[model samples]
Target: MKPVSSECAVGIDIGAGSGAKMGLFTREGNLLGESLLPIERYGRSPVVMVGELAGALRDLVKGSGSPPLIGAGVAMPGFACSDGTVRCNNLPFLDHVPFVPMMEQAFGLSVCVVNDADAGGLAEWSHARTELLYWVFGGGWGGAWISADGQVRYPAVDWDGDDDTLHYSNEPGYAIPLSRERMGVELASLGGSWEGFERICMAEREWPGGRLAGPNGRLDCVRAELFVSGNGRWRIFRTLAAADGYDLARLTPEERQALETPSNAGRVIDRLAEQGCPVVRRTDLMFGRALAAAAEFHFRSGPRGNCPDGIAIYVGGKPSRALPWFGPEAESVMRARRLHASLKLSWFSERNLNANLAGAAVLAWNRLKGS
Candidate 1:
């Protein structure tokens, strides 16, 4: 362990299943030390979770020679508020839990909290120092937008859980509605059906906010995530392959096993795309089109030139790694629509750093600098 100075910060990225990832970073955003406290260690109780996290953080700082902490920033999931209370459906134990104040008290340092997506966006800003859109595709699509001046724009702060209350800029996946009619046409072009895709989605969790709404409030659309995230991408591959009469039964045992597993399907689809599989190519193309629509809605809602032409939309999460396949089509469609937002792989990811932890470090650095 090296002796760090006062220009150090602690970042806490709390995830579902009571997992907490803590990192020690220099003011320059370099990760100095890192540790994880999994659910198996802390269980599901919020009190125990915080207590376990506090000890882990203390050890993280102490192991680094206990440098004078600049501050601590938490990248949280769900509707996290400034008062330390959070309404996280994934980590239901966090319901109304005063995480901010508790961590501050536990750590004896200034603390700040933000939504994990916003933290990822902030991490992008930390590296690029430019206005950017940050989208992470996983089970759901989470995103954020940072201004040219490093201010987070339209953050999902203290969301009241109202469908209309969510802005496309912040909650792009959930707020942006992909026109059902347009999607149906696209699916038909590939010999697929809207009903089939919807069936795949409904077989799992029901759509949040109920039936989607389109232009003029008409219920003729679907949530953008249903066609954008990892699961959605997997769904696209399955539905398209099934429609094109590509029988999975013909695949090797390993291939079928990979695609059949929901958690591993997106990677399998990406692998198939890499092999130049027509069905996989078409699947990503469909996803690219969906992204184009969401990007248009996202850029238009923000201030002028915030996402200027050629500015990269820095992305994170596992699915973002496949941007090389789907990105060109997305950028192409966006350009055809006169939108110039370019999609790029996450900067932090390329360096093998967790975006959430990096972003939390950036948040703490910002808080320290602002003071």
Candidate 2:
């Protein structure tokens, strides 16, 4: 832990992993230091986790030297309320916990808690004055809207603490479930889980179809076409997965076992991808379509009205890191809806990876400045 270059604020991102990510960012937006601490080592006890995180943070700050930590912000996987309660379904141990007070007491500094996706949005808003919509496609879908004034405007009014999901009702809907059901057989062969499907998506550069036995003794083959959201909950676009002539019946024992459970599916999918499955491309294309559908719905019936002036769209999270195919598909959907506004798809990288942390740092700094 080298000494940081200047005065900085601390930002933390807590997710489903064994630890939480923390970063030190300057008011100028430079990330001076970053670390991942094993807070989960404290187990499912929220109070214990908070205490451990505080101790670890104290050590990190002390090791950094000189420049004082003026304020701190936390990006947790939950819905943060004005009353300081956090409703985290993924981390159910933290349900109804008073996060801000807990952190503020432990760190002896002002602390603000926000949803991880909102933090990402704030990170984007910090750099640009343009209105934007940011989506995080990771463990579960979540998003935020950034205004021209550089504020992350979340749909707080619609948040139900007991809903048990990270996302709010105002953002784009989750698409993986529908995608799985639509591409059932392809996913089944690949192992029937997102991990397996995502492996194929990343491995193949092209999509090829296969002809397999259909119901009623019909031999149907279809190319992979994604289902898009229409006017309401119904799929706006429909297509067939025309079978290309290929053999899919040969499955290794490992593949069979992988298909037996959701957890094993990813490993199987990875193996299939390594063996060069062509259908991976189709799943990738479908993901792009999902992004498109989400954006369309956001503007059409979002908490905010249509952005006639258009909005920049920032896609973040684990999936966005692996796939760079959301821009075109999202724009295509916007066009199909006859709503043309500038839709920019931001890729995942260092430029945006620490958005939540950066956003949190900015918020903390603002609090210090009494702004």
Candidate 3:
């Protein structure tokens, strides 16, 4: 008797600003292969996007030697709707588009969709099956809450376009506010300036993408994302340098220029932090504090009865690769505040898995099993 082939799933991660990644994975979550589709290939045409994505999916399935496909799960950088539509701000072309159904219709495959950040959480949940916070630090901080039962709690599916209505678990960076007064205190201790930081924020802040208001539309505080993100960390570095009088003797101008690249800045900061550069160390400390501040609000005001006291925060995203530098400080501060939660590097990170794609695969497999 011949052995039956294992069933696989298709996982597609769509980045609004970037492009799309498609991967084939077995039921056990091992990736068989993957492909990339550039945004330019699809452009703004929904028909084109769907056609290209269909080809990619077919290629993945064919490349896997005609293994039975469980289903397809798509991850997007936007809020997902029940009717297979997505509201993507960055990819204006995809906003209000029935993206999931389009892809499914094109390829005649069962398909599901989820927010990218939530997808990352599902990836972690697939491993731990516990209540946790999944936070991704990029240009903006994105997040999700996974229940102990492996469901995404408080997903932003029904968002009304008001930042204030978003739940802390679903949008911690946008809904949580780091205290301005506390920031001033943190800055003063390290010879940094709150005024200078504000100035930089004002100059760099983009419309609609950033908000000066805090949780519930309070004006006295800044959204946690303004300081806890990739570019946000760079802003901290810039502000501290200007305030404390940058010591170029320790870091060359060329190195300083390299730090301006968000993709490369985390590595540079990690190296400099290891070398004990005062500014880099202090900047990380400040960033960590803001991160703690977000967590504090989440635990204190979130669905406390549902989650355990020591809920783990699984960190994701390229920027979070620097968690080894900032996570310790955040953990320490949370401990000092008596918040029992721990800041943990994501399971995806430890396993060297691409969080979005892996998570999408898990989601697809689960849907196929009627979970």
Candidate 4:
């Protein structure tokens, strides 16, 4: 019999901000290469954005010396259905657009679409030798999970008792209600939105004295410009804390100094822990978000009685002291270790490559094997 041609697949991960990444992999799960492309969307015009992105991806493949393209898997933010219609929250441009057919026409390849967080979970599971895996998106606190056999088993439309209501796990917007009624007001006053918090964190890092550039003494500047710009809240906070005392008008000199001090942040984290809440550093929060997603996945998928052996993979930057409010790395390690021991599972972090690509490779390999 003639040998069957090896299948090659590509995984495309689309973020809420129209950021795009593509991963190329062989049927055996070996990664060939990956690239990031920009997708410009104009208000609910996902069709246009996907078309533009498909063209760019085609160009990337062509530029890469013509690697054979078999199929493509896409990870997109928003509500996606089995029929391929996507109702994107962050990128309204894709609202109810038929992305699968459009991509098929543009690239002439079979395409599978999955939720972005689900894709991250699948990728992490595929790369590691674990029976359970979780993927978390920190910016909006979105999460998803996969089982040992590569099946997504949590946060499904009908999984929990709530059949009528759709659940978007890990989306802070959908988080368990906070008891403090003024918490929202406090969050807003601090910056206005979660994104606002991230911005103050980032500006505090990128541009010292940047806080003074906005209303509320640079609060609006960080909110309007930096935080909303992308996912760099931790960096922003670090920068601001390190800057001269004048940058933080919100806090008195003594308070600012106290915040900048390592011991203070540790105490804050300890207080949160004392309350039975996990006080993750912004950096570790990013890491734990991913881990939590994996844990949730396992809890929902494995036998109801016990947890399974699994792994959590995180893709991001190394934690730094710039984000003092996030607490210390030692705290993160200790917490993670305790969680793993208690849950009887394993967790791992990889900051090098995007997790979506790793997921696409797995999907492609599975399809190639007819599994």
Candidate 5:
């Protein structure tokens, strides 16, 4: 038999607001060459964007001087269906766009379009071939479940709400406070009343500030998830600030700057922990437990219960990468449940900064192999 060609593939990660990044990767997940272009460089025109992306891909392959490119993969921030239609709220240009066909035509290769979060999950699963629960904690929180065979379960079943993204702010139980009558019983054991808690939250006097306070705050409808890194960190900061001894003044200008823009919040929280703030640890623990609770909730009611055991949780994005303790903290929460399944945590970048791209390439490589 003629030996099969061991050619490389191309992967493109196109995230909203971050422009486009393309890379050449061997089937083994090694990044061979990479290139980038700011989204604005294309003037937000789809035709122009695809043309620019195609040029970048050509440059990446040519620059690498690697094997023939066999396939291509594209990752973007949006809801992409297997049929190639994408509904992107963040990348308005991609709304109802058939990006797969566009890329395929541009590059003359089989192309796959996947959600950015699912791309991360695919990368993690490729490393272990285990049941993977990968969460990307960047601008916002997103998660994907992969079967042991590396099949990603898409269109994650929504949890008891109209919201799509999984964050505490949108989760039913955590989204708001219980009613006054309901709170009486809920808080009776804790020796506090719902009314009292609402007062503090409404006054912005304590934990659960205006965003999570008042009857209006407590009974608000589903809001958009905080996909912005700065917003996510601000949420963490406010939650931690509620606890006693949290020195708000210790915040650096950079840290404070994160609160105003969409940036990595995990790094700031980790820095605060390094600064000797006990509240940071406490908040991390809370956040970790919240993640566990989300997992448990999904296992019980969501669509991920089938492969509970052998599950590995991969954490990445700017924040989780900076905070090494994030995994353990979340693991502690998962273990505390004493459930049927065991979970493990690791970084998505255990291989490279181009983990998403690596996974996209892997998906394309696998597609070619299957064909």
Candidate 6:
């Protein structure tokens, strides 16, 4: 293993849901510590919130004995310039915010900013075996091709027609119309957003037995029936359930009971199985397929031999939430059933230091040393 440099880099990922997490990654890919903070929406004033966030980070580092700082990497939800000008439609307040300079001045450290999905892809590529990898999250997607020699081929940036070089942008969601079309209706019906679908799906799964309820009372059945009627929602639910292990007969009983108790969206799968749907509970195929599609696109779009091995770094709640139905064994089973490319899911939760942060640190260390 390569030794990390004396300097450290921080990877700050800002989620669209107003949550922020900063990971302090050493050159050896060791996450020294992390801080999660909530963002308050105060009308186009992200600078204030982010400044406060930086202050919190400073306090964390100072309290932890003041390790030497080197550079920082940020992952934001919108298109970002090399200098860190962010234009996130969702974060209207952050549009055109000079976040990089603000943080750099606040922390007295160098800062590098990238799109959130791009950072995820970079983190994933840092651990990937293949040279080329594609990554996607709920709102957007991106790709990165890593050479065996460790050179990263980023999508070109079109800066005033002066910096027109080939850079890889993980804007797959923008390029792939079908992906958005597939989920459009469901997203709208479900309150015109996909922010918490994963949590919602999990709630539906655990409803009758879990803890979510409605105004009338326990809402297991009502929610399930509404989800079933929606095309995208139904498909996503069915696919996830299939990945888990429920059979058709079990699904039917659950669905019937859910009809009586709408909030029972949690048990719809079991009910559907009982009613004779050939569905089985499985991992969230939507997330898996979206990621696979992005990778596939990257593999097929460029020079064939130049394509690098693929990797994916998933940063979210938990594999259980994102990959709820499938366990490690089930991943292979699901792959076999789908007969698609062999894509693997590696969990990189914050709780696990080695799995999540080490690889990126090592990769960064190698990059800085020109290895």
Candidate 5 per-residue lDDT over residues 1-371, each given as its tens digit: 23224578788888776688888777777777788888777967888888888888777666676457888877777666666767777888777777778878998888877777777778887777777777666655666777777877753222333333333212223222223353334233333343443443345334344354322344432122221122434454454465353565667777776644435455566677787666555555544544555555555544324446435656666666534444565566567775444444444555347567767777777667552
lDDT of 6: 0.46
Off by over 4 Å in 1: 207-218, 301-310
Runs off by more than 4 Å, candidate 6? 1-6, 41-44, 139-143, 156-169, 179-298, 301-340, 349-371
Compose the digit string of candidate 4's lDDT tens values, residues 1-371.
23224456888877765478786777666666677776443234656666767777776666555677777878777656667666675776676677778877877887877766666667666655455434242443344545667766543321232312323232222322222222223333333334444455544455445432322233322222122111333333343333322244544566556555333443333333344432223333432333333334333432331334334423321222222323233235335544442221112233445665566556655554454
RMSD after CA superposition, every candidate: 2.6, 9.5, 2.7, 10.9, 6.4, 11.3
Off by over 4 Å in 3: 1-4, 208-211, 215-217, 248-254, 261-263, 302-306
Q: What TM-score, to 2 decimals, does candidate 1 have?
A: 0.92
The window of 10 residues in a row where model 6 has the poorest summed lDDT is 221-230
- lDDT for each residue of candidate 3 in 1-371, tens digit (9 for 90 to 100): 23327888888999876689999888777887799999988999888999999988777677767677888988988898898888998788889998878888897889988889989999899887778889888888989889888788887685788866777777777777888898888888877878888877777646443656676668788888889898889889888988878876666777777776665677677777788888888898888988887787777874532355588888888777778778898999999999888888887787666899988988888777655
Candidates 3 and 4, the one with greater TM-score: 3
Count of steric clashes across candidates, in order: 0, 11, 0, 22, 4, 64
**TM-score per candidate:** 0.92, 0.69, 0.92, 0.57, 0.76, 0.58
lDDT (Cα, 0-100) at 58 in candidate 1 = 84
For candidate 4, give the lDDT of residue 18: 45
Which digits, one per residue and each the tens of the lDDT, describe model 2 over residues 276-309? 6554344344545555544554456433434433
* lDDT at 131, model 1: 81
Residues forming the 10-long window of minimal summed lDDT in candidate 3: 300-309
Give the C-alpha miss distance for residue 210 in model 6, angstroms: 37
lDDT of 2 at 286: 51
